[model samples]
Target: MESLGIQHFGAFVLACIALALTPGLDTFYILARSGREGRTVGMAAVLGINAGCIVHTLAAVLGISAILMTSALAFAALKYLGAAYLVWVGLRMLLARQSARQPTVTRGRGLSAAFRQGMLTNVLNPKVALFFLAFLPQFVSMQAPHPQWGLAVLGVSFIGVGMLWSMVLAMLGGQVHRLLDARPHLGQWMDRACGTVLLGFGIRLAMQRQQ
Candidate 1:
């Protein structure tokens, strides 16, 4: 069942599922949104994140991602921009004040905001672009007529797996939030914890060197 010059298609998909299952920044971000808001918003965020992944896939196919690997300045600029955005989002979360009686961001607005935030959080990360550039090549058939199609297929497969995992995280987070809903302060504490983690991720990303 090989298509688009993709070798070991089954293995590639399995690898993608494993990667998606691994706990990373994306997992935390989706869970946080689900816990704080609802599953719907979290799913919206998932869509946005997938959209960003699509951008990376296109970049990989078009050789744009190669620029990040070859150009240190371009890599550094994107890295810093992503880190700054993460830090800003973290700060906003940490500084936010919401009572049990008060809701944060109306439903409609929140959905759009979540989508944008998720997209930006993903699109700005240079690491993802680099990962796509490096990872896709390994699975492509060396003897393929057109290697780019294989890259695109692999990229889409990975993104699809990741989106499904994120949806699961959203549902689970929502359930957990429901269980803890009685304690308003607990929700606040949860936000603080998520904020701290997000802040830490930003710092870590900022400190990361191009490898």
Candidate 2:
């Protein structure tokens, strides 16, 4: 693998960390659900999100992302599906606004269900796959030496950053839930906020250009 300069590596790490902190679908879903259901569900969402990241990593490594990227029909079809899913999720949240006056928990098959939800959310979103294909490769230096190794390192780093940041968010959600548990009105508002944010992200993802 090619050696990176300290400055380049530092910059890359910072950028990745920032990306992780940004509120995306995974983040919003985890935080919102965590606040409502408790840490267990939040953690489940985190696991699911990471699982999705793994899929992205594998797709990028195997060159499946390239195929999706180059094919217009495939890209369009995936994009619409992802967009529709987001819209659907958003609509669900909006409709639930009045009904969400009180926090209610949905029984799952346990953490496995949460993890699956997280993974599916990430995996099903074609934009995420495309993101890995486009974003992670930029840091790799193919001309330097072992391009594959470099890509591997970058991909792994992205996943690690995502995992760590998500755990932190999950913890925060738990804390916020505790703080707001006594205040149902505040909790309701938080749910609305999270739902709105998620809806916006879904829309943005749908409208994203393949290029």
Candidate 3:
């Protein structure tokens, strides 16, 4: 069967991959967890993130995302909320004491906790929802009988691209952890770096317009 997706399918996939590869808040968060904790934790985080993305996709299907895009006030409200959440997460990371050694996952609070945090982190950032609202529709063809179906295809594809990239980063981070196992301070550096990146993203998001 023919693909049910964006026009210029090759270009769209390439763009999605490029966006995924560009190291941003998501990448940093994945790296921080996987590098410090292990691949398992990173996988959990990835799953959680995708879970959150799924929710956004559902919201888009429900027309909630469209409302934000169309209404300036709604857009602003969500944008600020997302910005605040990102900044808050960043601040928490910065304030936490740095550990010289690789962090260990708490036995009881392992994958589930990481997963929940990742889900919340993604869901709270209205930017993700907005991003889907703006980005997916562009690839869809106006001539298509069901533009909403096209949107779904593109949104799911975007999530798939992101997941693939995150998986690679997670493994790479785990490798780095093993390499730097002897140097405890490296873990501390990772925390600081992640915190800094998150803060920067928050600031940037706050400044963005709905366009």
Q: Pick the candidate with the highest TM-score.
A: 1
Error of 3 at 138 (Å): 2.6
**Tens digit of lDDT per residue, candidate 3, span 1-211?**
0144458767789999899988767787788777767788888889898899988988886678878768999878878887887787677666677446534322136688768878877886667888887777667775666667777777788899999988898898788768657677766666667777888888998998877
Ranking by lDDT: 1, 3, 2
The CA-based lDDT of model 3 is what? Answer: 0.76
- In model 2, state the lDDT of residue 160: 89
In terms of lDDT, the poorest run of 10 residues in model 2 is 99-108
Which portions of model 3 miss their true places by more than 4 Å?
1-6, 98-109
Worst 10 residues of 1 by lDDT: 100-109
Cand. 1 Cα-lDDT: 0.85
Instruction: Flag regions of model 1 displaced more than 4 Å.
Output: 1-3, 105-108
Q: Per-residue alpha-carbon lDDT of model 1 for 1-211, expressed as tens digits? A: 2556778888888899999999988898888888778788888888989999999999999999999999999999999999999998887777678784466432236788888989999999999999999998888875777888888888988998999899999998888767656666677677678778888989998999998
What's the true lDDT of residue 64 in model 1?
Answer: 100
Could you tell me the C-alpha RMSD of candidate 1 in Å?
Answer: 1.8
Better by TM-score, candidate 3 or 2 = 3
